[model samples]
Target: MSLIRKATILRPILYLLVVCSCYGDGGGRILVFPEDGSHWINMKVILQELHARGHDLTVLRSVESWYVPQNSPLYTSVTVNPAPSSEEEDLGPDFFSDLMQRSLALRKMFPLRRFLEQQKDTMAMLLTFHGGALRVISAILDDAVLVNQLRDSRFDLMLTDPAFSAGVLLAQYLHLPMVYNVRWINAGEAHMTIAPTPPSYVPMYNSQLSDRMDILQRTENFLRYVTIYVQERLVIVPIYADLLRRHFPPGADLVSMQRSADMWLMRVDFVLEFPRPTMPNVVYVGGFQCRPAGPLPDELEAFMQSSGEHGVVVMSLGTLVSALPKEVTEAVAKAFALLPQKVVWRFLGERPAFLGNNTLLMDWLPQNDLLGHPKTRAFVAHGGTNGLYEAVYHGVPVLGLPLIFDQFDNVLRLQVRGASRVLEAGTLTTENFLEAIEDVLSNPSYRDSMQKLSRLHRDTPLAPLDSATFWIEYVIRHGGASHLRTNAYDLPWYSYYSLDVVVLLLTPCVALLWVFIFVCSRLCCSRLRRKAKQD
Candidate 1:
């Protein structure tokens, strides 16, 4: 070949080589601290994106993920599998459900006064269970072989959810910078970490109150805040601290270390959640799990198409809620039978006997895809954050059956915004459940409101996944990018909010007023004495 021809062939090859090299060449090793399979789903999408971007990703996950399906790519792809011991297996996949069930029972059986008193017992039990879980998780993460692998891995950062203290323990053990990916929309937890909005406008998690609260609601929110604060700091954090101390070295200060995470990837946004001020290190990645609906499976497509013009309703209580109580299941079945809309209920155990001809019961579902379908009109859900966001992303109105944790609050806010109706588990009846579905379906306003909110959620400058990946990479590139952390983390609560300044300003004014009044009284007494002498 001539020299010019050879150069032309070499140029094409060079271009191809450069393109391939640049595709995902961020070249950072990131460790994802494994969690329960269900909550891990929240991190899966973003982590996959990070992985595709050429970051070396490894997950330390449970060997037996009961909640994670065998076929799930995310679970199957896990690099390090921590096998569950007999005791750990006994804890069961429904451990979270069992906790939520207790909270639900507390909400139902007692009045506010009685509930507050009893909450201590519930909290104590939760602390015990959480402590046990942490020990097991720590054992897995701190396995001699695993520890050696981690130590030799040269990982840049550890990304995890701090719901369990194990992630923090692993990070501390390996001495990697920690970043948090929170799944729950717990406002109190956020306040402790980054933002410190007043309870007057910022409702407590699971309070079921709006941001703009009445005096009664505000008082309740404040009380709830106090309860959560005390429970987390005095009970939960102490338990976690103790657990860490057993395996790790002293002087770890686990709570402080948790608070000082380089970044927090919160599964919340102002569109669904009420507006609140946030610190620079806190990033909202709500609707990050949302994506364009792909082609549905044949059976699911047929089920949805059966509804025709009336459209379909999607009912799911998330992965945590494997099955409802028999009575509630029957109630839902009866309610769905009466609706013109076809119902696709995600029921894992035995199918309810009363399940209507119009309804389809499946053990698993492609929930986001179903919600995005044009035929999907309304969602009857347990008000879990992911399901709620998917509904919002698709502009589908909802009939909320809020069970526990932040579900009550999530549904209440949707109700406040006129996008849904909540049938509290305590007050739920078949008639009420049916009526709620009808109300959401018949009402045009609910759909309209949801559509408006959907627009806002989808109108982000960057897709939620991309935004999350960018921030994750940013942290790696700048070595934690700790400059983004606000000084509020370092300041005491009173100093951070300047309550002392308000107290100082008020103190001098009150002192001056007291002195002025005393002088006037003395002058009056002297004038009276002079008048008497003259007389």
Candidate 2:
């Protein structure tokens, strides 16, 4: 072999050796307790990256999980049979669609009435969901053999999605250092639990109000903020009471356990989320799952080319929601028909009678690939965090049909930024939907705003995924990130708020004021007596 050829052949081998030496013989052992469905999608991305980096990952999944599979090439799967009834299984496929329909119905009522009813319904749903989750964890804990095996495994850390408290509780029980892949905790947005969220500016989840709030809006925000705590205390905390009492220390509670995480990999960016106070332990890795688009399939590419001058519009309501209500879908179909742009929709339900020939309906489409297509004009979405971030990443303007949960708030953020238009599914009509579509298509500003946002989101020191991986590896290298965490979680509520300190500081001043008042009154009485004597 020639000298140049031998050197070239040796180059890659030397590089591989260098990389392997940097990571050591074998990577850190990581245990992942993930939430099911869409949350799993996000977790899976991180797991894949971690696996690629030479980490040994073990994923704990429920037998009835819809998304977290029992078999995977990335990680060793540990499937736990919680009970005869599983939370994931109990929430049948139609759960989200049904919830969306109920939410739409509530939207038609008086605003106050709607808020009250919605709160009631939401609380009931949360209780049921969390209750089922507790059961699953309880089952796992009860399995002494399984618990012992997990303990003996000597896992470096527990990485979890704290959407449900199961992983939090389990991590605490196993005494593992935890890193949370979290956006929402059990009560509400993760920030509400760990940061100082002043109601004056930081809007509450589901308020659908922006950071800039007037007095009335601030009042609403404050009330909603109080309501979240109330729900957490009364509704959510009790669901985990038994598990905590049995498995944890006397003072340990769900919120405190959640806050005790070593690091929070917040799946949000300030470009997409309203700016708020954050903790040292919290790291924003928003759009970690997003990447530059790859080539589309031959058939899909042909469709894109066929759009010609008009371009194509892509729509997807996320994974959980396969379709909207019949009336809403029909109206949407009619609107898509009116648009000159070709439509590609990710629809799973029966075909809408009004669906035009211009529209292509598929059970699934490569969402990221389609959004990145050169001929892609605009996106119609349900305002999921993943999808919204993907849209921002791709710089595609949106027409939002927000359904439930954080969808309303997610779309509102984009609308506030002038990157998207929002519509209510309850009041959707063919004319309004088409008008909204036309407005987005015709207006140059929406695309401009979104493209600007894309530039900002992309203009980061490191890719969000790489940042997340580094932090995860950082946690592993150090055993835990305790130094980054705050001692605030250790303080009692009164001490945390400084209520006791306020009382102590005020007590001396209050006593001094009383003494002064008494002396002044006595002097005045003496003067009055002397005046009477003189008279």
Candidate 3:
């Protein structure tokens, strides 16, 4: 080969070598701090992938860390004692249960307005409590011994899910390079600070409004948006400020600490979400937790096979909600018994008496495995993003019973896209539940819609895991990837949107219009005077 040809052939090879050399075989130590319980499940795939890539990892254990299997990789595990007493164990569960019970209390209120009004009361009560497990964990990290130990560990990077404020605070305390994996679509003040989620167009969390809204819906969404600041400003900000004053370094504030994160791996994609402006620091890694279907356990396989031509339906309400209310369980059980398809439901505590011969109950099931199976017809779920993304991955239609948080919004998006129907858990009835299941099962359109969305979801050139891993390593290689940071975070809302500029430009136009009006009046009066004189 000629010199030019040889050089051209070697160019890409040389680049690859240089890239590999930069990142190197000796990967840096990574510390992962996921909030307790199901939050860990969301980050499992990413952390597992990172561990497989030879990065040294230290994972702080919440009570939920016991779920990690013994055969897992050699990552260092530390169980943090946030409180000396047994009380800390209950804090996480209590925080969630308190919010849920308060939400459920609105059932007696009878109307949407009353529900929202009662919800505000719940928020007020929730804000007054400062002993949440996440806050306690942050305090534990602030302990002098723990802080000194973490600092001495010389961790090159820290990864955390910012469900609570602790992750950001902990990162700030340790002065480590940080990356956040936010597992929600609309991360309250965080997205508002980094991205422009216009309230008129983008729906607020739990608002139950679609992307395209009518006048009333837009007004409601705007009102909801305004209320979001009440919690952020009144509750989250003040508490974190006190935490900073009490435990963390003096120089850092919440906004700056949050902005300092190198990259935010968000669990959202354009396939399911409305198109909106996003900053460079925000990366959409929606299906990071989804995986190819593995073989089901023998009994499950046999059960699926027993469904015959009618196929099977899988129902799961996700990890946080282990059991539904007794009446709700009976309603779901009644609906499932009527279906020709076999049903596998995830339930805890006790099986309802109404459960039929065609249905099976388990405290846990291999959800993704069942969804990917050919015999699976539809999914009945709580519309958690994790489950929704898996359904999208496997091309299964959904019947969503949205109970709380962003589940409502997830189901709303699914309904808009013609992939699912939603029923409010509080007001759900046996008849409505039965009709929805039949509609999704009997109609081919739901399946077709889901298939189309699944195609779009998987059509990206790189798989989500690959994309996430690349960016994560990229951050490590480049020493925090500071170039991706946007100046938008530094600007005030009015300045960023250029409201002042709009007023400034409009001033000249208004002045010119007045000048023309005055000139016209003067000319008319002059003509009238001349005519009068002439007369």
The true-versus-predicted C-alpha distance at residue 486 of model 1, in Å, is 1.8
Error of 3 at 354 (Å): 1.9
Model 2 deviation from native, Cα RMSD in Å: 4.5
Query: lDDT per residue, candidate 2, 198-258, as tens digits?
Result: 9999988888999999999999889889988899999999888877788778988677788
> What TM-score should be assigned to candidate 3?
0.85
lDDT of 3 by residue, 248-281 (tens): 6676677667778898888888899877778888
Highest-scoring model, TM-score: 2
**For all the candidates, what are their Cα RMSDs to the real structure?**
6.9, 4.5, 5.5
TM-score of 1: 0.83
lDDT of 1: 0.76
User: Top lDDT: which candidate number?
Assistant: 2
lDDT of 1 at 230: 74
Q: Which 10-residue span in candidate 3 carries the lowest summed lDDT?
A: 84-93
Which parts of model 3 are misplaced by more than 4 Å?
1-23, 62-74, 84-112, 118-130, 184-190, 247-251, 492-494, 497-535
Instruction: Rank candidates by lDDT, best first.
Output: 2, 3, 1
Clashing residue pairs found in predicted model 3: none
Model 3's C-alpha root-mean-square deviation from the true structure amounts to: 5.5
